[model samples]
Target: MTDTALSLNTIQVGANARVGDYLALLKPRVMSLVVFTGFAGLFVAPGTLHPLLAAVAVLCIAIGAGAAGAINMWYDRDIDAIMERTRRRPIPSGLIEPAEALAFGVTLSLFYVMLMGLAVNWTAAGLLALANGFYVFVYTIWLKRRTPQNIVIGGAAGAFPPMIGWAAVSGTVELESIALFLIIFMWTPPHFWALALYRAGDYAAAGVPMLPVVAGPEVTRRQIVFYSAILAPLAMTPVVLGFAGWLYAVIAGLLGLAFIALAVQVWRETGERAARRLFGFSILYLFVLFSALIAEQALAPRFAGLPGTGLGLWG
Candidate 1:
């Protein structure tokens, strides 16, 4: 092949690589949970938003989450390169430039927050902006490398979605929305510590002060049980608050128990597998708990007469 033609082909391949790499910077797996929880908040809120506007609200949340993830990848590229789990990420893998990722993240963050303010209520937009800022500044920059309590406080960023979702419809933050926020906030420590327990070596190598890396695995395991114990009851806050019904109560109770069971096993077992299991189950537990709330809310109109349907405990 001619040298010019070969050069052109190489350029094309590089361009193609960037396309996918940019998306990877957004951390789509994490974005999915943000979207689901945000939607759940919107779905269960007391008032109604136009379907089109509702879509916009959810889209804004998703984009805001993605924007934060991109910025996180940009900021953490150094430690990400060192950590085994994140070594192949876009910036660390050299598929994308840090400057480009930062620009992309900042652009999306501004765009989504503005779009939310214009399309939805400013309350929701403000919360979205707060979430993005907290994730980028508080969690990624300040906390991640500084303290073992990183995820404990940083988890607040992830917890904002439901509150934002509620504000989208209600035009104000409510006690029920705060209950949703607390669920994820409390769940985050146990969920992340489980992974940290198993990946303590990677955290230490990266100089990230994850719980297990700073304290021993035994301490991490104990902390996990402690957080899980709190989370089990926190998950039921919706039912107690009268926003969710017995359906949600029962499912959340079961899931919370299972979550505690897994945490206990992580504490007792001397194997990484136990930690891994807790990590995996923690994801399922949150997903199912939120899913139960969505289901109960969605079915409430149709099953109004049924037990544990429309009225909730107080209604």
Candidate 2:
């Protein structure tokens, strides 16, 4: 028997994988962000979706994202076992078998995509399929170990959720949806690189070529600042394009400045604390940006006369 088989056998003995262990394989926290952004896309799209259909769309997105996370855990078990932050994950910690995780992920992927096509629309289903495939085949298997640019390029997978959500409602991809996609795409590098700065040691130990480990922290910090600069203006695209109102513009402007300021702090400081701060705030920054969009959309009727109310633009 192969050593890997023997190891699996040994780990399987007396193993007690539970429901929560299975959930852990899905990476719920990451799934939450995906669902939120996907919902934002759906909510802000120009057309209306039946509330029931809308719920299905969001559910499909959440499950599809979780499936991708599960597959990632299965494929990266080796590196995950090596990384301190990931060593205790279900598969690596022997709470769940690798093959089981893979099968679970594959099943969920098929379920969500097929359901989306049947219940929602084909365009949304196709995008969900593409996103699942990209996260699994492209990001997890292709770029992760081979390139420092993995997250930069693979971020497209995450960026697809909003577009899919928009398509779910509009039944087509549009310029406005693309704007949402760009906002997330451009925000990814700086957000991830900040975490990479503090987690360089973990990534290096696992042999994953994250930017901070590959090009050094100094370069990573600078890149963070560069992306933040571009993202600051990019966040205001909805207002510039006439879909968003002045309220969104003002909120986005203030948030963008804060994002850039934090990025600059990361660039100037030599300590990991600065990187950690950026990492924490990056999550908040995105949550707030999208929240502002959602709020504006919800409140548009009541505040129609206010400047930049985002009221009349939707078809």
Candidate 3:
């Protein structure tokens, strides 16, 4: 194996000098999705919140997510150094010491969870902390290197945001929160497996057993289609369960079908070019799917006495 530490040696001395590298270490893109989806869940919940407290809750979730990402980067530094797609990350590229990343992540994790508990409620804060721990201890350290099913099970970390949001608003969990959780949970596999299909070489070189690497491209492709088939209807369950209305149903149905079709095409693909297309489209599919949910919940008119009234954000 190539010397993993050598990748860090390539960084210019004091390379993470700017404020931006530290911010980049926090993985803002991933945090943004966490924060937004959590907020949407809060909005959809059947209650009012102190706006400032709700803001603090979302902020805590975002920081906690970033902290987890930082720690994940620290632990995965070796594999990251080997992967072409991740060779330039701050830790792998030596812009930030792995120890520094670890300390930063731990500190933020403690701070966010504690502050959230004190400022909001214990339930939301607990979920945030649990997600951080699960991502690091369960996904990064254990399952990732051991099994191809890692992402499937470990995806619970990513799906926790909506549950956290719902808890923040309601100070409890409920059926609708589970629905929101299921939406993201089901969406995770196909989305990630699509990327794995395209990036199988990088994963294989790193000695990581991604689905596409361990099972081969054909098996991964079939699994993606199977997961997409399951995901399509689950994405629309919120509407069926009465948390959302017809608008959401229509939009989610259409997007879910499109997602399945794309996965089917990907199943038939034989090489990198096709995998790349599927990978790119999967990101778009997720964004569109979530955006449709937000739009239908926030903008569409509501029926009488239903939670979709204009008084709250989700109506």
Q: Pick the candidate with the highest lDDT.
A: 2
Sliding window of 10 residues with minimal summed lDDT for model 2:
304-313
Per-residue accuracy of model 1 over 1-315 as CA lDDT, tens digit each: 999999888775335455778788889999999999999888888776878888999999999999999999999999999999999998888778788889999999999999999998999999999999999999999999899999999999999998999899889998989999999999999989999888899999999999888888999899999999999898877877778778888898899888889999999998999999988998888788889888877777344222232112222
For every candidate in turn, the CA RMSD to the true structure comes to 3.9, 4.8, 5.7
Question: Tens digit of lDDT per residue, candidate 3, span 1-315?
Answer: 357677667655545556787788788988877888887777777666777888898899999999999999999999999999889889877788888888989999999999999998999889898889999999999999999999998998999998998888788888888888888887888878888888888999999899999999899889989998998899877877787777777777888888888888888868767667766776676676666666766675364123642126522
TM-score of 2: 0.92
Better of 1 and 3 by lDDT: 1
RMSD of 1: 3.9
* Local accuracy by lDDT, each model: 0.88, 0.89, 0.82
TM-scores of all models?
0.92, 0.92, 0.91
Which ten residues in a row are the worst by lDDT in model 3? 303-312
Model 2 C-alpha RMSD vs. true structure (Å) is 4.8
Question: Which pairs clash in model 2?
Answer: 245-308, 246-308
Q: Could you arrange the candidates by TM-score from highest to lowest?
A: 1, 2, 3
